[model samples]
Target: MSKISTDPTRRALNGPTMGTRWTALFHVDPAIDTDPVRAALQAAVDEVDAQMSTWKPDSDLMRLNAAPVGVWQTVPMPLLEVLVLGRDIGLASGGAFDMELGDAVAAWGFGSDTADPVQIRAAMGRHRNTAALEIDVAGARVRKTADVALDLNGIAKGYGVDRLADTLVALDLPAGLVGIDGEMRAMGLRPDAAPWSVAVEAPDPARRSPHSVLALHNAAVATSGDYRHWIDVQGCRLSHTMDPARRAPLVAPPASVTVIARTCAEADAWATALMVLGAEAGATLARQIGLDALFLLRDPTMGFRSKAVGRLFCDQCPEAAAQHAQ
Candidate 1:
C-alpha cells in the first residue's frame, strides 16, 4: 500500500540506538497517540542491532561468527537477508566491499579493541581467505568456509533505515521520510505534493555544507566517506573503511561516495564499495550495475570534485550542482 497522506498534521518520532538514532517523519491524524507507534519503530531497529551488531558479543551475528567452520548456523530472516545481500555486493565488487572483516576492523581499533599488529597480521593471512562467506537464504542459515571474521557494520545502518521505512509503511504512515544516520528513505510527497528535499552533505569534514539537495520520493540514499571517521596511524590519518586487500584502513580513501537505490541496504553497500574502488573504477561499476551514484573525489590540485551517474539526483537543486561544477 502506498502511504499517501490523507491529513495535514505532521508528526516526527525518534529514539537513540546504534550510537546514533532512528527517526520517522510522517503525516498523522490529530488524535493518533503515536507512542505505541514510536515504540514499534524503536523495536524494529533494536531487533536489527540484536541480530547483526558486531559490537555486541551476544548478537546473533557474533554467535554465528564464533561457531565452528562448516557448521550451519540458523539466523533470523533479517540477518539472512543482510548476509545474502552483503555476499552478492562483495562478489559484484570483486571483494572490495567485504563483510567479513571483523578481526581487521577490531585490530585497526575501529571496533572496541585497541590496534594489535599480531591480530592484523593474522587477519591478513595470504592464500587463507581472500574472501570466504556462504549463506543459505532458503534455510535462513549460514556457514563459513574459512577462519575469517564477519562484520556487517558497513551495511547494518542502512538496513536499519530500511527497517524503519518498513515499519512506517506497515503502520500505514501517510507520506513521510525515515532515516538512520545518513541513510534515508523518502516514502511519498508532502501535503502539497512537493517531494521531500534531502541534502547531500559536502565531503569536507572540517567544514560541513550541502553539496546538493535531492527531491527524493520512495527511494533511499546512502553515503560512504573517509572524512568523518578516521584515526591517526604514526602521523598518517586512516579512515575506518577497511580495504580487504591491504588488510588496513584505506590509505587515501575517496572523500565520499553517495548512492541512491530502491533500498537503503543497497545504497549503503554500494557507497562503501565505490569508496573502496575510488572514482574511476567505482564509476564504471556503478554504470555497469545501472545504479544512481555520485562519487566525490579529492584531488591534490583541485580539491573536491564529484561525478554523478545513472538516474537523476540533482533535479531539485540545479544551483548546488552548478556550484559543484565550478
Candidate 2:
C-alpha cells in the first residue's frame, strides 16, 4: 500500500466548460508541484472528450455508430468498457436506460446541432430496440440487427468522474473528490477524518439553493433533471430524457432523480433509469434493487417535493428503509 500522507495542502484545477464547468481536486505530497498533476487530470478529460463526446463527430462513439452492421469495428478500450457496462445496465433496468437514443437526443436539440424535425423523425424511424443489440463481451464486439444509433451522454460524465478518481488514486493520491458538472465521486476522507461533502441541487430552476448535503466516502453520486436541458415547442415543454419506447421526449412533468452507488457510472445510469420510471415506479424499482436514491417531484402547490429510497447517507449518517415520504 502507498503511504497516505497528510503534509500537503489539497490542490484543485478548474477550466472553461467543455460542455459545462468541470472541476478536479486531489491531495498530493506537498513537495510535488501542481502543474504535472493538472496536466495529467486534463489529459484524462481529453481522452474522455475524444472518445465519448457526442458533440464530436469524430469521437470513437460516432465511429461505432457509423460502422456497418454485422462487422466488428475495433474501438478504444475505454469506450468498449463503457458500452459493455451500459448494455448490462440497460438490460437490468428493463430498457429504462438505453444508449440507442442518439436519434432521439439529436432530434431534441440536445446533441451537437440544433433540432431538426426531419432528422428526429428519421432517427426515430431508424431506432433499433436495445433488446435487439447483440454484444459479445469476450469477443469485444457488438452487433445490431437493425440500425440503432448510440449515445452515452447519460452516463459518460459520471464514468469520466470515476476515471478521474481512478487516475488520482493511481498517482498515489487517493484522498479527494472529483466532479464534472454535478456528478461526483469521493475517495477516502478529508484530512479531518470526515467524509467529503456534496450538495444536492434543488430541482427547481427558479430556486438556486441546495436542498440537501451528503457526506460521502469511497462512493459516487449522480443526479438527473430536466431543468438544465429542455425544449419548448409551441405550448409544450419537452425534456431531453426521452422515453425510448415513445421515441419522444418524456411527456410527464419534470422531476429530479439522484442516485448513490459504489461507482459513478452505475449511479448515473440508475438516475436516468429512475427518471424514466417516474416518481412512483422509480421509487419502487429503486427499493427492489437496494439503491440509494432521492426522487423530487414537481408538486402543483408545493413547488418541489422529494422522497428517499433504499439506503442513503446524509450528514455522515445512513437513513434506513427503502422509501421515505418527505
Which residue pairs does candidate 1 place in steric collision?
none
Tens digits of per-residue lDDT for model 1, 1-326? 33444455788889987888888888777668899899999999999999988889999989988999988899999999998899889899998889878888998888878888888787777443754767777887888888767889889999999999888888888478889887898887787877787788888878889887877877888999998888887898899998888778887777888888889999999899998988788888888888778877787887877777775634233333421110
For this target, which candidate reaches the highest TM-score against the unseen true structure?
A: 1
Query: Across residues 1-326, which tens digit of lDDT does each residue of candidate 2 receive?
Result: 33555475778886543587567776666678877777777788789889988788898888878887777776777888888889888988889898889878988798877989898787667645756567677777776666778889888988888888887888788888898889999899888787888888887666667777888888888999988788889988778898888777887744788899888988999999989988788878887888888887788898777777764722123222222211
What's each prediction's TM-score? 0.92, 0.90
lDDT scores in order: 0.83, 0.79
**lDDT for model 1:** 0.83
Candidate 1 weakest lDDT stretch, 10 residues: 317-326
Structural RMSD, model 1: 4.2
The numbered model that scores best in lDDT is 1
**Which regions of candidate 2 are displaced past 4 Å?**
1-6, 16-18, 124-128, 313-326
